[model samples]
Structures are given as structure tokens and as C-alpha cells.
Target: MSSVDATPIGAGAKARGAGGRRPIGLLLVAAPVALVLGLIIWPVALSVFDTLTVHGPQGLEFSLEAYRFFFTDGFSLRNLWLTIRVAAICTVLLLVISLPIALYLRFSETRLAGYIQALALFPLFVPSILLAYALIRTLGPNGTVDTLLVAAGLPKMPTPYLTPWGPIIGLVWDNLPLTLLIVLAGLANVSRASIEAARDVGAGSLTILWHIILPRIRGTLLVAASFVILGLFSAFTLPYLLGPAAPEMMGPFMRRTIIEVDDPVQARTQAVVTFALCAVFALFYVRSVARSRREQTS
Candidate 1:
């Protein structure tokens, strides 16, 4: 009988096993990683390329002229400031409003807790355009708000639509669901025993919340705030329908630059600027999530 080559069988088995794992790993990890990288990197790369390149006497030359336009133009500067202001205001408001509601839901076992939670999430179910239109109908001239006042035989106030406050209100409404969900999730992780123990020791609700609940979920609040800032800074739909034309938010400003003014390069430059500002809040959100996970793991 011919001597069989045992090495071939063993080596073939090893090769098959390794080959199988390679494909599986590629499917499980590599594909999704590639998808995410494409989603993130492509837009950023395009924005940077467009922003930094300009039609020169030669062919295309790299310049910071797009950024310079933003700095030099009064409207662009005001638009940037408006975005920053809106983000800051919305973040603070969400913290104030969502935190208490989250805490209440955390502690409540009443019949209405579910209803309240559902109500808080109502904005998420509604389409943003629909919501924006609803806001316009409520705040526009002789719209629902004024009509209700007229029906009540009261003086109709000036229309608040097409103003900063119109979009601000819409943003607040849209952002509430996300804020509530984050805070509520954080509250879920709080030790019920710890809270009850504090209660047993005669700690008041305010004291328990301030000392216990707040400390426990501070990271989560920061995460929520970061997300709110990111969303509000790059907001498009709400700002488009509701905001004023003079001092546009970054989203509408970039849009108008492209469509109305026919300046795609400038629009992309504004996009890069918006992305840079949002990166700060994105970093904070990442760090907050990392810290929360590390704490949980420990």
C-alpha cells in the first residue's frame, strides 16, 4: 500500500477552517465597518474637497477662500452664530424639561406613567415635515392660534411664523423624544435599593434626586445634551420652513447658497464648517457613552 500523506489532510483541514473563518469575519465585521466608514468619510471628503478647491487661472487651486467668505460676509457670520445659539438654547431647555419628566417616570407607578411616556414620544412618530407644517398653521398669519383667539373674542397676536422662534419651538418639540428616552434609560440603571434606602433614612425626594439620581445620571445628561446640540446645529427641515430669511441657520444657509445663489463650493464650505462645529459635540457624546460603559462595566 502506498504511504498516505497525513500532512496533506491536516493542512487541508487547517486551510478550510481558516478560510471559513475569514469569510465569516468579513461578513460579520468588515462589511458593516466598510458601510459605516463610507457613510461618514465620503460626505466629509467631498465637502472638504469642494470647499478647498476653486477655479483658478491655472486649473483648480486649493484655497481657504470659501472659509474667508464666511468670515467676511455679515450674513454668513450671523448664520453661524444663530446655529450656535439655537443649539445652546435647545440643549439647556431639554435638560431642564426632560430631566424632571424622566425622574418622575422613574419613580412613578401611577396609571398615567405610560400615557405620559407615550405622549413624550409623540413627536418621534410624527413626520418632521408634517410637524413643521402643523407649526406653520398654528403660528402663521391668521392660522390656528389666531383663529382660536378670534373664536374666543380675544385680540389676535402677531404671527410668530417665519421667525426664529417658530423653528426653535419646532426643534424643541422634535428633540424632546430623544432627550426623554436617554434620561429615562439612565434612570432605569439607578439602584432601586439605594433610592429606597435613602428614603428609609428619611431623605426627602428632592434630596434623593439631587444627591442620588442626579449624580448617577450626570453622564447620561451630558450625552443627551451633546446629541441635542448636534441635531439642532445641523437642523434642516424645521429651520427651512420656519426660520427667517435674513439670518439663516447653517442648514438653510448652505441650502440657499447652493440652490438660490448657485454656489455649490460655498455651500460645501458651509457644510464643512457645520461639521467641524458638530464634531465637538460629537466628541462629547462619544466620551459620555464611553464613560457610561466603563462605569457600568466596573
Candidate 2:
């Protein structure tokens, strides 16, 4: 201590310590980032490679053979069509149901609106697999729903389980929360003054909805639709359990091709195709968000 070098040794030591720790800090940050990139990038790369390569006459070569086989042989086309059909129908039905609920929540001070909201959001907490099984138990043929119907002297309706409508029903229930939340958020941004002015001029409810509400909520609609479409395109669990064997959705088709048909390369190629379709909608969703942000800032 008496000899201390008398040159602000403590400050210099602290500076050197911080400099040493800098690389450690950087490593801590980079490690997770590297892991995430490795997880996402590697599988995607493998899928693309599988999609573009074929065991051709030359042992291995790049070609569109996989894609041609998928499209022309109608293996992928049928699944793609079914996926689109279910997704489209669910989207339309959700919009039809969610719109009035949103409008009611916007204007009403009633407790019923609160209960409706709680019920609508209930499915968010239920896992899809559990819900799938629960639906089969409650609504399947000879299950609780049919029993009740028969007891009431009404014939039991056809079992929706293991049918297209079965998955459709489950998907609609699961997707309701998504669509409702979007519609409510869009409704929140609507100017109360404009709505009031329209009402003061004797504009009917449907007219106000058409001329005022619909235009403002267009972006929200796009966001909701994109989310639903993306989800349905990759739908696995619900449709897998409830849907029929023949006209399967893309998710089941992909898995069946891998496990049953023993075609990992083809399955991965199908996955690549599904993701590419989702990408188009994802780009539109991004653009819609960017435009909404710009409008708000401007």
C-alpha cells in the first residue's frame, strides 16, 4: 500500500476488468441467438434441399421431380384443396359470428356482453388435443349429445366426429378467440364521434356498420384471415384426430407420407410447399401492419 505505484491503479484495474467481461457478455448474448438460428435455419435448409433434390439416373441431382410428382400425381393437390376448403369455410363462419358480437360489445353496457366475451375466450385455454378428445366424448355418435337428443324425442343428428365437419367445428371453436380479438381491437380504434354523428343523422345500424365500421377494420380482417389460413394450412392435431382417412388435410398428409408411406423426402417437400403458401399471406400481413403503423404516425 505504501508503494501503490501512485498512478490511479484502482481505476485502471476496474477498466481492465470491464474489458475482460465484455467478451463474456457478448458470448452470453450470442449463444442463445446462435442456438435459435441453428434450430430454425437447419431444418428449413434440409427441407428445401429435400424438395429440390431427387435420386435421378445420376445417383443424385437437383430437379423439380419432387414437385412435379406432387402436383401431377394429385397426391398433394387433394390435400391442398381440402386444407383450403376448410380454412375458407371456417374463416367465413367466424367472420359472420364475430362481427355482431363485436358490435354488441362496443355499444352495450350489459353483463351479457361480458359473459359472451368470457365464453368466447374460453377455448384459448383448452389445448387442441384435449379439445379434440372432449368433442368426441361429448358430441360423438352415441355420446352425450346424441343421448340427450334421443331422450328429447328428436333423432340424433349425424356424428360430426371423424368427418370434415368435425374438424371444422373444432377449428371454428379454437379460432373464435383469434378472430374476435382482432375485430375488437379494430373496433376500439373507431372514433366514437363519427359513429355518434352518423347515428344523429338517423343512420341505421347496418348502414353505419357498412359505411363506417367495415372500412376501418379491413386491416384487422386481413390479419385475422392470415393467422387462420396459416394455422389451418399446418393444422395437425385436431384434423388428425377428427378428420377422415381419405380426404386428409396437409398436416396429416405430410405425417402419413412420412410414417406410413416411408417417404421422408416427399413429406419434407410437402412441408416446404405448405410453408411457401403461408409465406405469401405472411407478406401481406406484414405489409398491412406497416401501413397501419404509418397511418397512425402520420
Candidate 3:
């Protein structure tokens, strides 16, 4: 009787279970996937294509002229070097400022902690243009900072912030909140148990931080640094607002080619270079994440 009743019921049950998956799952995901491919992936692919072609008043010509021009262009090396320097300095400054705040928030129970965090994040709400204007008021000649410096017997002390260094300061200020938030999130995941155990075993605060906390949050730090680097590369508003008359950034270069020169091809070429830089960073970030995961797993 049992043999007669056996009819591969489990196979049919599995088939029904597979068929019951909500179709909305695919629809929900497909739209975003398609949109990204269409808007971002396709345009990036097209920009690379555009960079390979030469443009004239007459029409487009397929050539290596764009790539050739990039190498021989004025300030190509100088401006590129400046951009990297700005990004590197900003990343380092941001990490230095943010990591301490993040650590404080993680370990301290001060009554003002939440307020301090809120203030830190409040800068994010301020527009870059407004921030630049404010900085100009505070640090410009005859401004509050300069006024205070003169009153403090430090006349002829030019505000280093008025030069390219000024823009870097603004970049750091603008980027600090986001980096702090990310680092704090990573810090929160650190094991209090481990910290306490270290303390119990006669480890000093510095030793515990060096031995455990930094290693645990190294991935977060790398990710934050990557974001800052990419943001600096793509950023235009802050740099343009704060920069001197001869502002030099990849963004301004792209803008000039597109808007002033009426040459989309050159703009596309600059964009391709920026994309390549970002791609290198992205590959590094992916590898860093993979290494972190392997370490955690092992």
C-alpha cells in the first residue's frame, strides 16, 4: 500500500515552491539595473568611444588626436599633479580629524556627544557656494580671521587659505562630516568586550587602539578615503567657488571644452581620463574589501 502511494510528491512540492516566488522581485530589481546600464554604463562606454574620435567644425573624425592632445596639453601634468595632491591631502586631513571624533563618540559618554555629532553633520546641509562665501568673509583680507591675526601682533601674515591651499581647507571641511559618519559607523562595530579584555590585561589605551581598533576599521578608512578621492575628482562647485582667477581642475577643463570651446569631444576625452582614474581606485577598493572579507572569514 505504501509503495502504491509513493508518487514523487517531494518533486512536485519543490516545483510548486519554485513557481511561487513573487514576480515583483525581478521587476523591482530590473528597473534600477536597466536604468544604471542605460544612463551610466552606456554613456561611459560612449564617452570612451568619443574620446577615440577627433572633432572639427565640419564633423567627427576617427583618430588618436584626442589621446595625443591630452599628453601634450598645457597644465596637463601640473593640474593633474595638483588634483592628486589635493585629493591626497584632503583624504589624510579628513581621516585625521574624523577618526578622533569617531573614537570619542565610540568611547565617551559626554552629555554633549549627540550635539557634537549633530553639529559635525550640520555642515553637510550647507551649500558649497555658501561655505566658500563664508570662508571668504572669515579669512579674506580685512576679514575676521585676518583682523584677529593683525590684532594679535601677527601682521603681514597672509592667509594661506587665500591660495590653492584655501580650496583644500574648504574641501576638507566639506568632506569631514561624511567621512566622520562612516568612520564612526565602523568604530561602533568594534568589540567593547575586546577593548575591556585588553584593558584588563594591562594594555594601555594607545596599545589597544594600535593592536585592535585600527585593524578592525581599516576597511572603513580605505572606503572613506576612496570616496573623498572620487568626490574631489568630480567636484566642481566648491573648487570653482573658492579658486583664484585661473582655476585649474579636471572639471573646469571639461566644462571649458564643452561650454566655452564648443567641443564635446575634448570634454569627453577629459571625462574618460577622470573615469579611468576612478576605475583604478574602484579596483583598489574592491581588492581591499576582498582582503578584509578574507581576513574576517579566517
Candidate 4:
């Protein structure tokens, strides 16, 4: 009698074994995820809890004092509004400056590509606070820029250092390179064949850019803008060093609340509010990424 193929059964058993090992592989991944969750969840949850309860001069107590302080507190809304405004301004400036540079890097075949990339990232290597100091020395009273202006028969201009504009300028300088890098990476994935096709179809450069490149890279643009917004919003060093005597950032205020005012609870509240605002933007960014991936796959 001819034996039915036992070899087929053996092959099927091997395939089943491979499939069974996948769970073990997944279990391995879960360990690091669990570690991260363990580290992050507690602090975040505690802050949220703290935001609900009150810690009066007497001690910690269950009350809405923190939120009350945030809402009824003078200048809180003004500072929050200013923070949002600054973030919006920084996002616009970053995009306007970085996008054209990114496009040039992607479309140009010049050898200066390496030089340009290095130059773009050079600011990133410098620390924010250090950059602030450097800017001050170059543009502050009797600084290089002022001396140059005087030599050129121009009056010495007032230094912008340690002012509202100081932090804004510093934030842009610090974050511009990173924004450019992200946009450039996105532009790299634009289909060259598709661009050429558009050109063949009598599409002008502007039309091709407007229709083909922008739509394809919209996700990247959003991601870059989100990063700039979040970075500027949470910025500490540059704003602390370069901004006015009382900068309107949650960072500086949180420090004052905690250290100078000796109110840990208020500081925690500010931290949570700032984090929550940024978290909302982060969630949108993640959603955009997911949608972009789905579109690409479909």
C-alpha cells in the first residue's frame, strides 16, 4: 500500500511550531514596554491627582485649590495665552524658514548639500543657554554687532537680549535645524517618477510642488510643525536665560512656584497643564502619522 505523505504532516508541524514561537517573541517585547510604563505612569498619574487636591499652607488636603488658583489666579490666563501665541509664532517661523531650505536640499544636485546640512545642524550642537549668551555678546550693549554698527556710521541700537524677543529669536535658532531635518526627510520620500510625470504633463514647477509634493508630504509637515510647537512651548534654558526678567513661560513660572514660592503643588499643576497641552498636539501628530501610513498602504 502507498503511504500517504507523512512528509506533508511533518512540514505542517514545523510551520505550527514557528507560529507558536511568535507569542514568546511578543512576550519579550512586552518587558521593555512594561518597564517604560512603570517609570512614566506613576509620576504622571500623581501630578494629575495632585492637580485635583489642594495643598494649603497647613499641608496637603483634598480640595480644588490648585485648579482654583489656576482659573481664579491673576495672570495665569494671560501667561497661558502668551505661551500659545509664542508657540504659534515659533511654528510659523520654523516652517517658513525650514521648508524652502529643505526643498532646495532635496531638489538640488549641488555638492554644497553636505555643507548646508552641516550648517543647518551646527546650531543644534550648541546648547540653548550658551547660544543665548553668544547672541548677547554679539548683539548686546557694546557687543560685536553694536560695535560694527557704530563703525559703519549707524547709531548703537538697543540690545534685544533679555527681552521677549530674545527668547523668540533663540527658540527659532535652536529649533530650526531639527525642523529642517524632518522636512528634508519627508521630501526625500516624494516620488521622483511622479514629479517627472507631472512635468511631462505640462505641469509647471509651482503646480507640481503645490499638487504633488505638498500633498504627499503633508504628514511630515505636520510632524515637523508639532515638534517646533512643543519644543518652543516647553523650552526652558533659552527662555530662562534670554527672556525678560519675568518670562511668560510655564517653565520659568514653574521654577519660581517650586523654588522661590515653595509651592510644590502649584508647580506640579503648571507642569501638568503644560504637559497636557503638548500631549494634545502629540496625539494629533500620532494620528496624522497613522493616517499617512494607512494611505500609503492602501
Where is the poorest 10-residue window by lDDT in model 2? 1-10
- C-alpha positional error of residue 125 in candidate 2 after TM-score superposition, expressed in Å: 0.8
- Give the alpha carbon lDDT tens digit for every residue of 90-169 in model 4: 88988989888888878777899768878888998997868988988997789999999989999999887876777888
Q: What is the per-residue lDDT of model 3 for residues 145-247, given as tens digits with 9 covering 90 to 100?
A: 8788878998745764446777888899899888887788778668899999999999998999899899888777887788778889987876776765354
Q: Give TM-scores for every candidate, taking all chains together and pairing residue i with residue i.
A: 0.86, 0.85, 0.85, 0.86
Q: Is candidate 3 or candidate 4 better by lDDT?
A: 4
For each candidate in turn, give its C-alpha RMSD to the true structure in angstroms: 10.8, 11.6, 10.3, 10.0
The clash tally of candidate 3 reads 0
Per-residue lDDT tens digits for candidate 2, residues 1-298, read: 1111212223344445556656765565465557767997787998898789878787879899888888887757888888889989988888889888877877778999888888988999999999999999998989999999999999998999988999999999998887787778778877889999999999998999999989988888887788788888888999999998868999999999999999988898788888888999888787887787678669
Q: Can you give the lDDT of residue 286 in candidate 3? A: 68
- Stretches off by above 4 angstroms in model 1 are 1-23, 55-60, 150-153
lDDT of 1: 0.82
The TM-score that candidate 1 achieves is 0.86
**Regions more than 4 Å wrong, model 2:** 1-36, 55-60
What lDDT would candidate 2 get against the real structure? 0.83
Best by lDDT: 2
Runs of candidate 4 with Cα error greater than 4 angstroms are: 1-24, 55-62
Among residues 3 or more apart in sequence or in different chains, the pairs in candidate 4 whose N, CA or C atoms overlap within 3 Å are: none
